[model samples]
Target: MKNTFEELKIAKSILKSLDDIGFKVPTPIQQKAIPKINSGGNLVGIAQTGTGKTAAYLLPLLTRLQKPEGNDPRVVILVPTRELAIQVGEDIAELTTYSELRHAAVFGGIGWTKHAELVEPGIDIIVATPGRLWDLYQEGVLRLKKVKHLVIDEADRMLDMGFMPQLKQLQEIIPARRQNLLFSATFSPAIEKLAEEFLDFYDKLEVAPSATTVSQVTQTAYKVPNYRTKLNLIRYLLEDEEKFTRVVIFVKTKEHAEGVFKVIQRKAEGEKRILHSNKAQNTRINAIQAFKSGDVRILITTDVSARGMDVSMVSHVINFDLPRDYDDYVHRIGRTARAGNKGDAITLIDPADEWHWKNILKLIRKDIELLPLPEEVEVLETEFGENQDQLREIDRQRKIDDPTFQGAFHQKKRKGSNKRSFDDKFSRSKERQKRKKRRKL
Candidate 1:
């Protein structure tokens, strides 16, 4: 196996950029993928988010496109979200520093005219979300005829976000003879179907199994009673500012993200920001920048910021709520322990979340260490409504597992109750009618 980027025979200019960025060695995915991509064939890569998958494809594609060619973009990279588009654009800007390659990162949440202006000047590469890309193509501002390289990053996420139609349309628009590259963190049947549709006799590579967590990250879970207790625990953990330097807290919903942010904002040791789908594009970008630059110590967000975030120094990842999708747990924790840095992933599992957490364990095929709550952290009583919600969720899960299981929340019915009630009402009606008739006679 090749150990260094030099052994991989990357261009000197790109190597210099990598060196400047403090990357001396090629990750496993990078090592395996660069060669296959350089061979000029369609390829599919299965690897986790933090395993240097972006650069694996970018390095070779940039190397091949040594200089700018035509007005239309030669390379089109489609990502699932605006955040990922921005991140990929930044990477392209950084990697192409020594060379002359014009690129644009276009996504929704702003005017399409602005993106049109960016691409109108002539671009060699374009990183975009599917919706924005389709809009640009329809407006006659972007042309796909010159595209030689087509990349779909985070394919699983695209499916999750329902971008399959856009992807199919993109395939129809782009040139048929281009090199296709699809990289995803997990390989599912749906992904296989997508590959069948997108790639033409492509080579498939898997650096690691699907849904595998990063080995560098230490996994631990705390069995908390409810939301209030989780907040208290978070407060207690944040007290150690030195150990918990940079953290990303993942919540399941925007409401919960706001709640976590409010609590952390008041008592946590350092600055914090919240991110979700509802936040404005600029606000989300600024929050991500602050978190990346170490200006903010904590970022409380939904799964919106989970995939394609390339922060290397995150000290810990806190799962404030279990993700509804078991596969997302891997992506959430992957935000930490990036670029070969060791980090920790801590999950606060309430009673209702236990079943989901167990399912996550089964998916990842590993056991996370369970820890008792800290003595300083107070475990508040679970609220009545919250308790009932938990119970209801538990019942729902039980019913799913055992079709015949009658849960506590399930309503009970006595044997022959309906029949007996109907019979009693009929007898009373007949007796009243007979009494009326006798009186009339």
Candidate 2:
């Protein structure tokens, strides 16, 4: 295994930057992916988030590009979210600080003028979200004819967010003879198909089993009775300021995000921010900056919006609502236990969420130990919360799929038959009709 960044034969300038950042020993993904990427061959890296996959591709690419040569970006990194684009841009900027490399990060949610200004001058590398990149390309502000290297970060996420069309459009834009690299925490079938189309005979490398959480994170679940109890638990846990100093709470939807934010805002003091799709871009950016600067102690966000968060020192990651997509569980916990730091992932599982929690366990293919709530946590009722919301949604869907299927919730139960009275009445009516037909015959 390649133990040190220096052992990778990177330039002294880049090595000094890595030293400054305390990135000495290579993580599993970096160790295997670095050398192969340096060889200029197509590669697909399968690893979890916080495993240093970004540096695995970036370090090698940086070493290869000695200096900025032309106006068009020679290297391009496409991410699904604006937040990830910013994070990759920051990573590249830090690494290239010791050397002479100009990089630009471009994405939507900002004015077109800002992105045009960044691309007007030559850029060695460009990190961007796909939509904005395509937009700039259409506007004649961006070009890929000179792109020598192309990297797609979070390939599975791009598919989840429905970026395949933009990616396909990019297929027609980029130079055919470029070095390609795709990295994902897990490889779903969609990612597989995309990789096949994007790469030309790439090497497949797996640092760990697919969908596995990092070993450093101590993951555990709590059997909370309901949403109010979850709120109480959050208050109780954050009460220990020393242990839960830097925390990120993950919810499922913007509505739920708002609800959780309101409760936590009322119960807790100190700097806390909420992130979702609806908030202004500046608001989201400021929230993350504050969280990273340690100014914000609590950051409540939706999984879709939080994908770009690369915070390493988060003390705890609490799942306010389990993701409907089980794969997201890996990414949620990944926000903590980063950069060789030990952290905790506490998931509050309600009765309805128990089924999803089981799928998460099965998907990760391991047993995350369950911890009994502190003898002090308040037990709550199941009258409201995401569980109720989910039930209501399922009923709505059932109505669409089968009009006659009254949902488990909508039909009242019969006293003796233990069946829905509506169904029982329908059955008796059919029986009476059959008896009347026999008597007439």
Candidate 3:
């Protein structure tokens, strides 16, 4: 049975806020985690992104904050990145409009003075990135002793990016008797082990497993030979005229993201926006806002924007480069096809990424249909051996390196003396010539 938002037993002010926002029913994550949080028990919620995990924690925490019995900053949510910090802050702000809760978000890439100015006189809630929160705590601008609720969002991403140390430091300072909530899209073994330290007899809630993808997203892939060919394929897809109207492209690194953006802009008509780690905080925020407002039709981003972004109108998602972590694929594609809308997720696979390509299939546990590249897109690859004898020889070499070889083959030794040298001769000659010229001078 579907649970209604009013049945969650939240405070009247928060209920009115939910009505104002037209939140009729609780999402899966919200339905599970809200009850656990309201019970005053620590919880570990393993849910997918865009599953309303933010509201799962926010609604209950807001209700507790308005208890009027005790005061001091009652809630602290530690996120993985600055962008996520700002995103969560905005989501929480939207829900807290009708209440008297004072909240502030602290993150890097902004002035220290600004954060200090915001932290004064004790806020009811704080959303912060780990590093920036650590800095503020060290400077004595915030007090943790009175904190009643401690929430850690994106736990796996936090551990992946080496925020565990900072998170541990925070645990040492905050009050021991606080409600704890840990939310993550995917949880690794390391994170599962770490949960033992923070949560107390916690309720483990998982709406979906680690490898699940949204049902509304249609996943497809294209096999190309190299990066250049993949770029051409993206241009072709964008110019298809009927397939896409608004699209978000995900790449692996910041440099590749910008390069893809530049290539698309050079080939594509109309305006395009790029979102990566290099841009200023305001610029990144503006690009997201523009994309959400329908002013910008295309957004090129890295894994920085992969988690917890709730833009509902994206029509297409392009995986320009597959993420190393397969779980990220699910989050990247969830950007589109939201709110019962249909969307498509397309991936460009190059020859060099054969290993990474298999990982996606393994994660999805389903074979992805490979679409033939458009005729205008050229695939460049060197054919090793097409003839019978050459192909046999190549197979022989493959057996020697293959993991299943098992000492199966024996070959004759070479006749000549082997020159197994570590150093390059050309580099040695260049260095010697430069030294001799210096001596002559």
Best by TM-score, which number? 1
In model 2, where do residues sit more than 4 Å from their true spots? 384-441
Better of 1 and 3 by TM-score: 1
TM-score of 1: 0.96
lDDT of each: 0.92, 0.88, 0.80
Models 1 onward score TM values of: 0.96, 0.89, 0.85
- The sequence of per-residue lDDT tens digits that candidate 2 reaches over residues 380-423 is 66775666786876676567668888886786866676655898
**Clashes per candidate, residues 3 or more apart or on different chains:** 0, 0, 0
lDDT, residue 2, candidate 3: 30
- Better candidate by lDDT, 2 or 3: 2
Name every residue pair that clashes in candidate 1.
Answer: none
Q: Could you tell me which residue pairs clash in candidate 3?
A: none
